[model samples]
Target: MLLYHTIALAAGYLLDLLIGDPRWLYHPVCLIGNLITLLEKGIRKIFPKTEKGELFGGFLEVILVCLISLGVPCAVLSTLYRYMPLAGLVLETFWCYQLLATKSLKDESMKVYDRLKNGTIEEARYAVSMIVGRDTSELTEEGVTKAAVETVAENSSDGVIAPMLYMALGGAPLMFLYKGINTMDSMLGYKNDRYLYFGRCAAKLDDLANYIPARISGWLMVAAAFLTGMDGKNAVKIYKRDRRNHASPNSAQTEAAVAGALRVQLAGNAYYFGKLYEKPTIGDKLREVEPEDIRRANRLLYGASVLSVLLCLGGRLLVQFLV
Candidate 1:
């Protein structure tokens, strides 16, 4: 089983690097989002609108989503392994591949870079709006560039390394479960009136789940900066200084690393849902952020992802030897 898991992990990583997420296919995360919406509506109708009711409702929604995420894949994979082992391996590889977002993250962030490079501020803003939660409507060129770089940096943990760690631990089931929680957080875990009470459980769960992975991701980026010929020393320095700068415990971990690696500052005040947020700066502004920094951040992201895969493989082997 360990050997099979290692092979599946490698194959999935390679597949994501080579093909990314195809637009023609229906994604599993999309299905998870739909389930969250369905369950949230039904649960809200049963529970009162008070804080306690919303909190409990959010908890129930997470439980149901996690169960479906784990159960369906477990049943199908187990049945296939019993009847046809090779077929099961193929399906498992595909499932694991779908769980990762390495190339997709690079591709989406590059669109913003390309637009900005071509001197299309409006188009660049549109491209960036697709990925980030913050408003892009009135951003200057540098603001657009900063937003793109920050998204790539932050998602380096959320979209890539975290899923890789979960998949390594429990294969596809745990990976999808993590994704389900992440999706719930993305959809409903806002501080706005609509979700502040209702999405509290999801926000807390997501934070807890990402707590360790986010730190691992930070150190990994520092190492990757060295490997990719960036400022590793500053990456470490800024990471130590600014990792806790964010409102969320986990977000600034990677953002600080990437900002230092590229020798640029990130995370200042920004507009979100039409409200201005006074965010603290992450790193020193030794240099202004450029559109090219998006590409550099993607390079760091890929480097960190490779390091994570190697660590996961080594850790699995060590556990197997001890057991």
Candidate 2:
């Protein structure tokens, strides 16, 4: 199992290295998007305009989406384990890693960096808008850089850390299941009039799955920041200050640490779906975010991901010894 896991991870890293994120094309994750479209259509049936119908819709949709997404895909993959063994393991790992955004996150972020460096604020904003939920139509280059950095830092927990945690605990099936839940949450887990009812379960389930892993990812990022020759003092400081303000329990830690370490303010007022949302500030009073900071954030993120894999290897060894 451990060998399979390693092989899967290595294969995924190599695949991503060889070929970057195919976001504009046929990503398997997009199938989930189609699935959401179908579910949204079905949601209207349960959410007929009645008293509390909207409320009930949110809960049921979230629950149903999570169960259907995590359960069905994992069931299919797990059944393959019976026959194919090694091949099944590799395939599963590759898919799980695809669900993860570690490399994709970094690479997409760099696109924005490239744009910012060229003084193409428009292009940078457009590139950043692809990755984050925030509005970028009017953001300055510095804001664009900050958004890229913050998203990279936060998703380091989601796209890399949390998925890896699940794999270490329960191998591929569980890891993929967690990814499904996260994917569903990202797709439909909104709090607005439309998704507030139906996406409730997915949102909550995502929160539950991320609860532990996020914090672990955060601490790991702190260590990684220091390891990458960043200031340990500020890393810890931002973690303490800004980690709590993230909408998710776990995402905050890594973002805060990176923000502090880099000495930049992040997560302020931003537009989401045409509305401005003001997030509480993280980190100390700061300078304008530069493309260089995005590089630093990626450096920290890569180190943390490597650190996680190593620690996972250690824990598995410890378990084998105990057994």
Candidate 3:
């Protein structure tokens, strides 16, 4: 079983690299998002619009979402494996491919780069807005580039390494469970008026889920910098120096490493939902971020992802051998 899962993980990573999330297929995350929305609406109807009610509703939401996410896949995979083990492996590999976003992340960031390289500032902003949470309507070229680069750096952990870690540890069901928590966070985990109380559980859960994976991603990225001939020493230095720069404990880990690797500053003030947010800068201003940095960041992300796969598979295999 352990060997089967290890092979499934590698196969899934290769599948994601070859073909990213296709529009035609039904993605599990989309289903999970819909379930969250429906449950949120139903919970709101059942509970009063008060702090205590919201808290209870939020907890219920987490419980229901996690159960469905973990349970459905486990049931299906178990039945399938009982009937046909090979078919089960194939289905599980497909699920793993669906959960990862490595190729999609790279492609989207490059789209922003393409727009900026062609001098289409509006198009660049539009492309970047698809990936980042910040408002990009009034950003400069450098701002757009920085946003794309920063997103690539940060999501290298969230979208790729984190999921891979979960999948390696517990296979497909657990990976989907992590995705469920992440999707909930993305949808409702905000400090804004609407979600301040309603989304608190989801937000805290996401932070807790990502805590270790984020730090591991930071170090993996630093090692990737070293392997890729970037400034690995500076990557480690900046990562330690600025790892705590973000309000979210995990967001700045890879951002700091990538910034130091490239010797460019990232994460100053940025507007979100039409309001300017004052954020501390990460990395030194040794060089200004340019359009090319987007591609460079993608390279770093890909390198880190590859390294993560090796380590996860290697570690799992070693443990299996020892056992």
Candidate 4:
């Protein structure tokens, strides 16, 4: 049983490594993603559009899912894989970690850097738009670069690292359940009239799940920067000063750290659907962000992410010894 799990995981990772996130007909992740889209529609159907109603419903969704979808399934998987259970778990963990897109995140961010360095602000904005939720138009060179750097740092955990973290502890079903929760939070976890009530739980739950891992990823990124010969002290200094600059308690913490470490300013004014959102600055100073920053950030992300895996595996192994 464990052998199949190990082989399937390796195969899935190879598929991702070779083919990337193509919309292939047979990809398990894509198929799961599609099914999740349908599940979202069902979740949305149960709640009315009222703020009060949505809030209650959203809260219910988080509570119920935690107890059932994510919590219960993971518990079951852990029990089933019990033998030299720890070793079996190591295989699942590695597989799930591979599904995350840290490498791709770096690659995508670097594309923005490359275009911007070529003196194409317009192209850079267009490219950056894919990775971030903020409006890219009207962004200055500094703004665009900072946004890229910040997102690269933040998503290194949120988009790539967290999923793998969960999978190592759980397995496919629980991993998928986490993905569902994440996808729902991304799409519907808003606080305006439309999603205020309905999206409440998803947003909060996502925040809850991310708190520990995000900070962990931040620390790892700093170490990665140092190991790779970037400015380690600057990263630590900025992280200390700017990690809490954003409205989001967790996101700003890691992103601000990354900004400070890199010795660049991140965050400011961003346009979203024509509305200007004034955001706090994460780094101390503003410098002309170059393409190399993007490259450096990517390298840092990979180093940190891989290190995270090693640490997790080591921790699990320690647990085995204690048991």
Which one is best on TM-score? 3
> Model 2 compared with the native: what TM-score?
0.90
User: Could you tell me which 10 consecutive residues in candidate 3 have the lowest summed lDDT?
Assistant: 1-10
Per-residue lDDT of candidate 4, residues 1-323 (tens digit) = 43434443444444444545543434334544564455556766887667666677667666555455555545655675775665555545444544666656766888898888785899998999988898788887777877788788888887766765665454455566667667667776876777777777788778887888778888887888788887788889888777777777678766765676677777777778888888888776646676677777777777786687667555545655575
Greater lDDT among 1 and 2 belongs to: 1
For model 1, name the residue pairs that clash. Answer: none
RMSD in Å for model 4: 4.3
What TM-score, over all chains together, does every model reach?
A: 0.98, 0.90, 0.98, 0.81
What order do candidates take by lDDT, descending? Answer: 3, 1, 2, 4
lDDT for position 12 in model 1: 93
lDDT of 3 by residue, 1-323 (tens): 67768888999999999999887998888899999999999999998899998989998999999999999998998888889999999999999998999999999999999999885899999999999999999999999999999999999998999999999998898999999999999999999877898899999999999999999999999999999889999999999999999999999999999999999999999998888889999999998889999988988998999999999999889978998
Q: Which stretches of candidate 2 lie over 4 Å from their true place?
A: 1-3, 10-14, 22-25
lDDT of each: 0.92, 0.77, 0.94, 0.69
lDDT of each residue in 1-323, candidate 1, tens digit only = 66667778889999999999999999999999999999988999999988898888888988898899889888887888789988888888898899899999999999999999885899999999999989999999999999999998899998999999998898777888899889999998998778988888899999999999999999999999999999999999999999999999999999999999999999999999899999999999998888889999999999999999999989887877887
**Per-residue lDDT of 1-323 in model 2, one digit per residue for the tens?**
55566556556655654566675657666766677677767876867765377657656665665566567656766677677787677676667557667778888898888888875778888999998988789888778888999899888987888887787776666676676677888887888866776677778878888998888888888898789998778889889877898666666788888887788887777888789887787887657677899899999988888888788767766775676
**Window of ten residues with lowest summed lDDT in model 1:** 1-10
Candidate 4 has which clashing residue pairs, if any? 54-197, 54-198, 55-197, 93-168, 234-261, 235-261, 239-257, 243-253
lDDT of 4: 0.69
Better of 1 and 4 by lDDT: 1
- The order of the candidates by TM-score, greatest first, is 3, 1, 2, 4
Clashing pairs in 3: none
Best-performing candidate as measured by lDDT: 3
